[model samples]
Target: MNVLVIGGTGTTGSLLAKLLPHARVGTRKPVRDGQVRFDWDVPATFGTALDGVDRVYLIPPVGVADPAPVVESFLVRARLVRRVVLLSSSAVPESATGMGALPALVRTMPEWAVLRPSWFMQNFTGDHAVAAGVRDGEIVTATGDGRIGFVDAADIAAVAARALTDPLPHNTDHLITGPEALSYADAAAIITELTGRPVAHRSVSTEELTGRLATWLPPEFAVILAKLDEDIRGGAEDRVTSTVLDVTGRPPRSFRDFFRGFLS
Candidate 1:
């Protein structure tokens, strides 16, 4: 089936593109065949991306506070598409503040699956902290002793591909977590072992971290991130779930294994 992957150049989207060659990847910039230029912020480009697409792997732009309207707009345009698989976050519950709207709209689709995955292991290697830390030898966060189940982005893509290509149960929200939970301190230790350097996970207070992050992230988002860190420290995402095994029929990859493969 022909599929459209939003954010197609990103971590999970890139993996999905590699796994499903026939799928059309949507990006804001010009891309190769089976890829179309599309932007979530631009409504006029939605039709071009959705045209002839049977399914979609929906990834809302990051740091978006209200994605219901964006998702609703996409679903309206993708009327012929059979299924939609949304990449959501485990931190925001369906009933929680600033988290319920997108998934709620997706449930209205004929067939939909919401993948609420835990913190991505790639956030360290690919995106923010770890890559910078690798360059500078320091990883800083406001999460003090917070253990998180950091799932691999590849695993998230696998589940998304299944949900898009296979006959999936409708309106299902799959909470995907890693095989184990580890704190920032634990993760630092693993990185230190892998890189053979004196890397550190420095814990900062919420106010200070928020102030520091304000330079990079929007003030509102920085505040949300700080709260999320506190929530992590409270052990909200410490438990490993069986969703990955149940959906993919294999054990979720552990942090140590992921670190060895990707970080080492």
Candidate 2:
């Protein structure tokens, strides 16, 4: 089946593209041979991206407060596609606004799966603010004492590949997570142990974090991120799931193992 992977240059999307070598990569700029020009803001690109594609791995536009309108437009054009898999957050349930609302749309497809993954373990190693702080030997957050089951991006991509290729469609939401739940402090300690560098978790108030994050992100988006941290502080994300193992037939990699692999 022809598959279109939106956000193909992104973390999990790139990994998913690698796993499915024949998949068409939907990106803003079509640099590579298999890449197609697809932009969420540009509705004209949707038809071209969906051309002859039978399956889709959907990643919604980032930082939009409610992406349902534009995403729905895209899906309307993808009516011919049989299977659609959405990448959503574990914190956002179905029927909720923003990414949460996407699962319901994917469910409308002939075959569909919603991947509700916890926070990514790559947050400390990617281009996010946490990664910048990690490089500076400090990780700052408003999440105080709350634990998160941070899954590896590769694992999330693995599950997506399975969901896209499995003979029987998984018409359900999958809560993907790593094996253990860890606090930001625990994450810092692990980084220090692994890298021989003193990494610290500096906890702050939600307001302060919002202000800090606003320097880099849009003010509205910054507020949303800060609120998510506040929710995490209240233990909203402190749990694990067996989605990676169940879908990929292998246990998800632990954060420590991920760090080791990243270091090497």
Candidate 3:
């Protein structure tokens, strides 16, 4: 089955592309071999990326205030693609506005599966908010004692691959999560034990987090992140799910496993 993998250079997208070899990779700049120059902002490139593609692994643009318009326009021409697997957030409500409207939008497809994964385990390895602080021995967040079932990007991509290649699509939204829920303190301790780095988990207020993130991200995006932290602080995302094992026939990797992989 021909497939189109969006965000091909990104963490999960790169892994998904590797697993689904021969698939076209859609990126802003097609630098790597087999990568196609596809940008969500440029509709002119969609036809080339979607040509002969029966399936798609959709990765929405980050930091966009409203992704609905672009998503709507893309789907208008994505009529031939029978299957689409959308990467979304567990924190984004199906009824919420802005990017939160993504899940509901993809549901309009003929056969599609929406993956709402929580925080990724790659935060420490990649260029995420906590990565910079982890190396500096100070991981700061506003998520107090709340825990998150940090799903690994590998596992998320595995599920997406399965959704795209299976004889029948999952045809439903699933919340993907790791095996266990862990607090920031637990994460810091694990980093300290595994990397020999004296890491500390410093919890701040939502206001403080917004101010800190505003320096790097747009103010709106910063507020959205801080709001997610606020939800975590309220103990909203502190739970685990068995969807990973159910879909992949293998239990989700633990935080320790992801960390070890990062170290290697």
Candidate 4:
């Protein structure tokens, strides 16, 4: 099966691309020869790359307030494809974002699965804003003392691969999560233990976070993120789910292990 992986150079997408045997890895930049040209913003590029694809891993456009229209357009042409798997967030419903409408979109086909993964553990090791905050010895958040069950990107990728290759899809949305939940302070302590840096988790107002994020993110998207943080504070992401283990046949990695291996 020819699996077309959108956002194939990103954290989960890249990992999923490498796991699949016959995969077409899509990229916006011309990173190398044989990389398929796929950009969610450009509708003209979708057809050529989607041609002859048996299954697809759909990733919505980044920073766009609404990705439904773009994704809907692509799926219209990709109807011939047998299956599609979408990457979504666990906090989407609480934040009431565009991703909340995606499961219905995926269900338009016979075989489909939606993976709603929690905040990635990569937020610390990777060059994300959270990582920068950690490096600066402070991680600011509006999440107060609420806990998060942050899953690893690799675990999410493995589950995606399984969903794509399965003869009969699970045919439902799966809430993928880590084995345990931890507060930001817990994560900060783990970082301190690993890197010997006294990283602290600072509490801030949602409005403050929203304004600060607006400097980089679009205004609407910034507010959406701030709302999700508020949801986190309300304990939206505090539960652990067995979906990763159920799909991938192994428990998801913990945040402590992620920090230990990456920092060591």
Best by TM-score, which number?
2
Residue lDDT tens for model 3, 22-72: 888999988877899889889999888998888999998777988888987
**Candidate 4 Cα outliers beyond 4 Å, as residue runs:** 94-97
Ranking by lDDT: 2, 3, 4, 1
Give per-residue CA lDDT, model 2, range 60-157, as digits (tens). Answer: 99989899999998999897899999999988866767767888888888999999999999998988899999999889999999999999999999
Off by over 4 Å in 3: none
Window of ten residues with lowest summed lDDT in model 4: 94-103
Clashing pairs in 4: none
Instruction: Estimate the TM-score of every prediction.
Output: 0.94, 0.98, 0.97, 0.96
Best by lDDT: 2
Indicate the residue-level lDDT of 142 in model 4: 90
lDDT tens digits, residue span 42-108, model 1: 9999999998988889898778776777777788888898788888889986753355677887787
> What lDDT does model 3 reach?
0.90
The whole-model lDDT of each prediction reads 0.84, 0.94, 0.90, 0.87
